[model samples]
Target: MTTRAAGVATPRRAWLGLAVLILPVLLVSMDMSVLYLAMPTITDRLDPSGTQQLWILDIYGFLLAGLLVPMGNLGDRIGRRRIMLAGATVFGLASVLAAFAPNAGVLIAARALMGLGGATLLPSSLALISTLFPNPRARATAIGLWTAFFAGGTALGPIIGGTLLHSFWWGAVFLINIPVLLILLLAGPFVLPEHRESGRGPMDLPSVLMSIGGMLPLVYAIKEIAAHGPAPIPAVAGLAGLGVLVAFVRRQRTLAEPLLDLDLFRRPMFRLAIVSSTVGMMSLAAMSYLVGIWLQSVRGHDALSAALLGLPGAIAVFAVSMIGSRVGRRLGTGRAFVVALTVAAVGNLLLLGVGVDGGVGFYIAASILIGIGDGLAFPLVSELAVASVPPERAGSAVGISETSFELGNGLGLALLGSLAALVFRSGGDFAPTLGETLDDAGSDTGLARAASEAFVSGMHVATIAAAVLLAATAIVAWRTARTQPAAAVGVSAEPVGARH
Candidate 1:
């Protein structure tokens, strides 16, 4: 086995291993959105209640977010490859179960199992990259590819789902994972190297429980509030989650082998990177959700057509992600982030001009701009987070980085989505969402027009809110990057591809 040393170049085997690792990364991200087009079909067949349908859609993400930290730490203690392979096996089996599930409850259970597996896949796969590419510049390039694939997977989910549902059943989406995962399982042992920290003690069960208890309730509360406004149950759950998380942090500080290392946050760059990532992802998720609704509800496009319309933006994201690190090298990481975020902010601002009647060209332009910005920012944030820590602690760092992303996605949907919903309700006696409003409006042309106008108003407000947030984040990133030198941030000062 070759040791990962600073001066060493990345081997051909490492590139081969990266190809192997990409399979699970792609699938894990795709699973997050693959159900969007299939949901109506699923609902019709399973006849689940409104709440049950929501659970079926949401449980996977909730469980995945809740378990990421614990699983990351677990991978550190055990072996990243081992955890990753086990996760793939479970994910594959769960996909089979979900594909064949006859009832809503069974499907929900299977999705939850898939979440459990996904938690392992994301962090372990990212951390394993550190072992494969020890050179910081090469590592940055590899991480850029990783980020690209992940973004591509997420963007492709709807298109792929729409295509699958065109001829096949809703279950085909889940079944498609089987063959890809089978490849991962077959080639993983031969190509991927195992990595674990030496001399780590047993995991703290209480910490694991606390993290799960804290995250699940918090995430669920966020989703509930976004869906149905502030209720007593979600309010209490949110508060309780916060309390437990505070306790969890304290316990980590006191532990000999903490589940999460709090000291990592001591580095200002790491903290800033996390914040940037969170805000970037938040804007992306909120915009994606809003735009998807707008296309189907207002523009009256079918699922496949809407997805196709959005394809160029997705392609832009994929392309920018691949070159993000190279851009960072030219401009320097800090300035690069400023430029990227500012561009995204501009994109969000463009959405304010879109009207209920027509703005297809404007919307497409906005999406491509947003895609460029997010694509550039995401990879750098991941590279910075991983580079901020020692190799042995990479899994934990990746977990934290990824957790920020998950939380950001949830928060964007909750906060911005709720804002839009509130605006829609205030305009008239409209339903919480545009879809429901149109469904209720039916053949009443006046009501439909009114509802459409109100929904567009809500979208504008949400879009502006997203824009303001991005701009504010950009200013903060600029200031922070200036104050904190690259070396102090646990990153090398040399330009990308620089060698000793």
Candidate 2:
């Protein structure tokens, strides 16, 4: 049997590799929200058709979600470093395409390419860090920083996008990704170590096809339902998507090398971590998109002003995440998760105060609380997910968990935002502009007032939903705490490629 080096050093190359890998997270997460703030500008200049507009906005996430699992599995078959470099190169090239696209169709295609690259970048980077940091404590710290930048990207993207749009066209958002990708491409080969299993497993082509087919329809149906009020076309598509999903699951069971290990979910910690992370992400994503509209359409804040208003949340997220490790240790994982959810629930309640009557102080306080709760919850959830799996399977575990968060972010926004729209229609407003929609219904007074009230109502409902999900997660986490010590070492003892 071949043994490997233990207690890997924190070499300069390793640190640089981490930096290079993090660029994708920043790019991906930034793109997720960057477009939200830029939507008004894009709509005005591009004058996109209804479907084209949604495509331009959502294609990145849709493609990213569809490809992540297959891409991760592929990385395991090939060398991770090779995949990362290729992904970085693709990402850079795609950014240029997006930046200069003449029409919405080209922009949508470019975004999809970027998402393809992102799927490769995300899982490969996490795997690289796992290979480089063998020590558990050191790995946790590294992962914490990694996770921080991922979260930070969402917060920072708007700030940067806001600044860019103030001077340049909306395309500047895509332009910004170029330099980051270039940095990764240049630095990756020298800095990042290569990782591949000793023997390559047979590729799961059937699973990949089924997954892509299943995810694409479902995501598209959700986006359509969000926009078009659950029409028959989307309804049928959603049901068909369910059928494809069932087929995918059956295919996975028959595969010699499954793309995703469904059995890992049998582990309690894995279940809780995925659920809680999904809920947290869903809540954050829904709110982030809605709040931008609130700031600009309702609150009458400019893009720059709206971005500035959101700074408190960004700062709070950074600060809280920095201290989360200590808090997790002190409170125990279950207790910490429950506490974080409770705090997030309180933050949501504060968002209820964001009526037309709210002042700057109200927005600041709400943003800070929301940001801090999300910051604290996610890293702990990520830790629990990987710790539940064996070191060798850590990459798969992490990838699955991250994928769940991304799907949840997209799904949550669709469901909650759609529900809000439905509620609005029932309440009587049908104006073309979002602000006017609220105004005619008497839910808001001024332009800013309408935006604030609309957001507050939508956000309140979403938060209540998220809080309910977290409450369930808390129960699961409590059960997980009892099994953690055993599971951590238990998983480590298992050999690679062994089914859970």
Top lDDT hit: 1
Worst 10 residues of 2 by lDDT: 486-495
Clash pairs, model 2 backbone:
298-448, 298-451
lDDT of 2 by residue, 1-500 (tens): 21224544556656666777788878887887787778777766766765575567667766777777777777776878888789888888898998888887788899889988888887778777777777666667767777788777877777778778888988898888888887887878888888876565777787878877888788778877766666988888888888898999888788666888887776655566677777777777767776777677666788888888888898887667766766777766656676777677667666666655455676678778878877887777666655655555555666786787677767766766555554444433454336445445563346434444555576567656766766666667666666663343223234334644
Candidate 2 lDDT (Cα, whole model)?
Answer: 0.71
Candidate 2 RMSD computed on C-alpha atoms after optimal superposition onto the true structure:
4.0
Which 10-residue span in candidate 1 carries the lowest summed lDDT? 491-500
Model 2 collision count: 2
Q: Candidate 1, residues 1-500: lDDT per residue as tens digits?
A: 33355678678899889998888989987887777656656766987765566577667767877788889989988999999999999999999999999999999999999999999999999999999998876788789999898877876777787778777888999999999999999999999999998887899999999988987778778767776778999999999998999999999989977888777676666666788778877787667767776777788877678778778878988899999878877776777788888999999988887788899888889989988998888787788767766777788878988887766765776677667766777889875555666767889889888888887898899989988988998898788778753533235433211110
Supply the TM-score for candidate 1: 0.91
RMSD to truth, every model: 3.9, 4.0
